[model samples]
Target: MTSTVYAPHDHHTCITAALANAKTLCESRGARLTPVRRRVLELVWQNHKPTGAYELLPQLAQDGFNSAPPTVYRALDFLLELGLIHRISSLNAFIGCAHPGQEHTTGFFICRLCGNALELSPERMQDVNTRLAEELGIVIEEQTIELSGLCPSCQLAATTAKEDIA
Candidate 1:
């Protein structure tokens, strides 16, 4: 529910909490978090950046998994279906959902420089959806709003560089 990518925090704690939450959600929902699926999730959470399927394939292969396209695809499908991960349309990459097991709209703030992605709270996107629905009279079934921009750190660095040049 919170965006922590731009903020300074414990990376290991975030990953550990996510994995634990995922395990609990899967068990409660009667879904099996298989070894491959679990590993894929871990790989996805390696950083706050989005990772493409092809990028993960080689990692899986190096980790002793089958590494076939179908195998990886299936795991991704399962993760997506469970709402454990989200695909960024623009990047064709996947990122772990900060808030799962809840119905909500997700927005991504992707850093153009570092490739870091931050998940915006659903409430932040609801306003846009409401306006569009009212104006276009269309129902939005699936939503993945991605906005490309520099994150706080990147912005600061850019500003610092400009200052030095001046």
Candidate 2:
């Protein structure tokens, strides 16, 4: 498991590990992580913040890659297909999946202030799925529970700002 996104840690290691996992997974699946796709993954892993396709356009353009909307969209879609990334529907942004090779319950806690997101994949989520499926008698295809609020740092900042005004 990776370190909590809220905690301070060596983030370069996160990017490195994610890339290695993606490569291994692609090799196993007989799929390729092409240049644009790889770069897009790298950019998404730059931080815990969710990345929008448009936000990546200029970055890719600066690196002499085609920054067309379709190119980036296709790359993002490809990564999503390989389970290398997750899309935040509310934000219309994408984040790197901590667990890349498994079919697991997924959720996200997005910071309203900073837009940083922490992925949550708790075992209990599976229980919830089970209850819903068994009780409601319906099959569960996919689901994501998203909660939004200020992160710890943002909460502290808001409190301090309030105190300063008093």
lDDT of each: 0.89, 0.90
TM-score of each: 0.93, 0.90
Report the C-alpha lDDT of model 2 over 28-91, residue by residue, as the tens digit: 9999999889999999999999999999999999999999999999999999988999999888
Task: In model 1, state the lDDT of residue 105.
Answer: 88
Pairs clashing in candidate 2? none
Alpha-carbon error at 31 in model 2, in Å? Answer: 1.2
Looking at candidate 1, what is the lDDT of residue 10? 81
**Model 1 lDDT tens row, 31-121:** 9998899999999999999999998999999999989999999999999998899989999899999987777788989999999998887
Q: What is every candidate's alpha-carbon RMSD to the true fold? A: 1.5, 1.8
lDDT of 1 at 153: 95
**Pairs with backbone N, CA or C atoms under 3 Å apart (clashes), candidate 1:** none
